[model samples]
Target: MLTHLWRWTLFSYRAIWQIDIRARDPLHAARRAWDIQRDPDSPATVFDIIDEFGTTFRVDLAEDNPHLDAQPILATPPMPAWMARLLPRRFRRHRIRSRP
Candidate 1:
């Protein structure tokens, strides 16, 4: 019997998204937003993303955490003992706080 190696891969997809960008004018803002989306480190995900184009992407401004309303902010693991020792006591342990 042979064992198969498991791995995860990330795929890119095209979707319409609106982003609030601060710039001198509307055109500049749109350009800035486009640059951000083009960056490799952008946080955009393809999950539930549609391939259809020319469709409007509507978002309810009133709803916070619209897609992750039920998800809780998990606490981050503490820094290693050796790493913590190099920093001040206040910065040793860090935890992510939930929005009110």
Candidate 2:
């Protein structure tokens, strides 16, 4: 059996994320770690994010854990026009194309 886990910390203006995946059978921890590094957001895994105020949020796909069923917030962060210009042209085009 293999399982994935993640722990996150939030600082004043930065976020630190760490992930660990291990097996209960024959696979070595190193191999399990490699699998997790390849795709941190793969299906059937859990993701967690914590804020500075000690608020913990979790999204689990495992049957033994609780599930989150809330609607997503559709607001975008405010960015300066000049700062947006620093991104690659293709990324900017994709962002603009995705907007309604």
Candidate 3:
């Protein structure tokens, strides 16, 4: 009976996205998480989440950092649509421009 229930639960379970803050230095990670949690409007620079099952997921700091402007060129405008289409499939340009 237990085996049958477990199988049913597993089949019905949906994966949830959570940040797991289990770094080499958990204290630092915890502090960062707390800061983000405290300020609801604060942009999350670093954090992790744990699921109900105790599974943890790491949120990439580099990807989350607002200061790090590394958005994909395809996502941005200013590049001519024709030029972007003309570029080779293998070529990807995502350079960060310095602001004056």
Candidate 4:
């Protein structure tokens, strides 16, 4: 119980920190990490940002997007544990059968 509480506390702290950073300048951070850009001339309906590690993130800020709420920003094909382990810790949690 104590160990689980500790892990949850650490995760919450990290998440809150990220939220604070994003609150300051979300678009800049997004662009720096994933190369996503919002153009005044022609803003992309779906922002695609690819990280240096080749991870693609799709961002949909439009409220009309049908799957906007439910869709995972970085959905992955169902993969086995061994394959999923190769992914980042943040992504591994979304894996079909990922184990911490």
Candidate 5:
């Protein structure tokens, strides 16, 4: 699948970090963001997340910090409207192949 560089904005009482994650989409990026955040203290939380198209997502992290809402926010999908309009139907439906 095509990998996009996503920005995971981490918010903590200690500090804030803009973590970069490469993944197929925002959902994958959110998962990876939690994984990346494991190294830090528990105070750290996902403040904001954005896809390549810059669409913001409200990622609700669980108490254990594993599970998340199926829909990003208000039933919004990972891909943004702008991207959906830009890409072809097939490209939007199926993931693009990525090179090693």
Candidate 6:
């Protein structure tokens, strides 16, 4: 029981962290979320991940995305759309200025 309780606590903390990381950097968070998806403790379903990407990145194509119903999706900045191919990923994430 004690071990299970401890594991649940850890999972809660990790879930919060995963949400935070996804906010700051979706790519890295995807990697981390993938890792969590493979782990036994993850409560996230495939639907949860799909929702996360669609909602967080505003890539909602489905007419029934749950997050889309709750709030309007935020538009992505124009520059970052092609910036990864032009600039390295790390630099592109930080460089929010208009193209030079």
TM-score of each model, paired residue for residue: 0.31, 0.28, 0.22, 0.22, 0.25, 0.23
Q: Pick the candidate with the highest lDDT.
A: 5
**C-alpha RMSD by candidate, in order:** 16.8, 15.7, 16.2, 13.0, 15.5, 17.0
Residue 52's lDDT within candidate 4 is 31
**Clashing residue pairs found in predicted model 3:** 19-48, 19-49, 20-49, 20-57
- For model 2, give the RMSD to the true fold: 15.7
C-alpha local distance difference test of each model: 0.47, 0.48, 0.46, 0.45, 0.53, 0.45
Q: Candidate 4: lDDT of 15?
A: 11
Candidate 2: what lDDT? 0.48
Candidate 6 per-residue C-alpha lDDT over 9-59 given as tens digits, one digit per residue, 9 for 90 to 100: 621111112343454577777888778767776654323211322222223
Collision pairs in model 2: none
Pick by lDDT: 5 or 6, better one: 5
Minimum summed lDDT over a 10-residue window in model 3 is located at 68-77
Error of 3 at 75 (Å): 36
Per-residue CA lDDT of model 1 for 1-100, tens digit only, reads: 1233323533332334666677999899988987887888775433233212212233333355455223322333334456567777786556321121
**What's the TM for model 3?**
0.22
- Summed backbone clashes in each candidate are 0, 0, 4, 0, 0, 0
Please give the range of 10 consecutive residues that has the lowest summed lDDT in model 4: 11-20
Model 4 residue runs over 4 Å out of place are 1-43, 64-100
Q: Which stretches of candidate 5 lie over 4 Å from their true place?
A: 1-15, 40-100
Cα lDDT of model 3 by residue, 1-100, tens digit: 7767864572221222334575568788877667665776755545343333333344445453533233322322234445666667665366322111
lDDT of 2 by residue, 1-100 (tens): 1233332532532222356556676467667766765675755355554433333455555557465552323233334456668888776754442111
Error of 1 at 2 (Å): 37
Candidate 4 lDDT by residue in tens digits, 1-100: 6767864552211111112225348677765434323345333345454333334455555546535234334544336578877888898775545323
Q: What C-alpha lDDT does candidate 6 achieve relative to the native structure?
A: 0.45
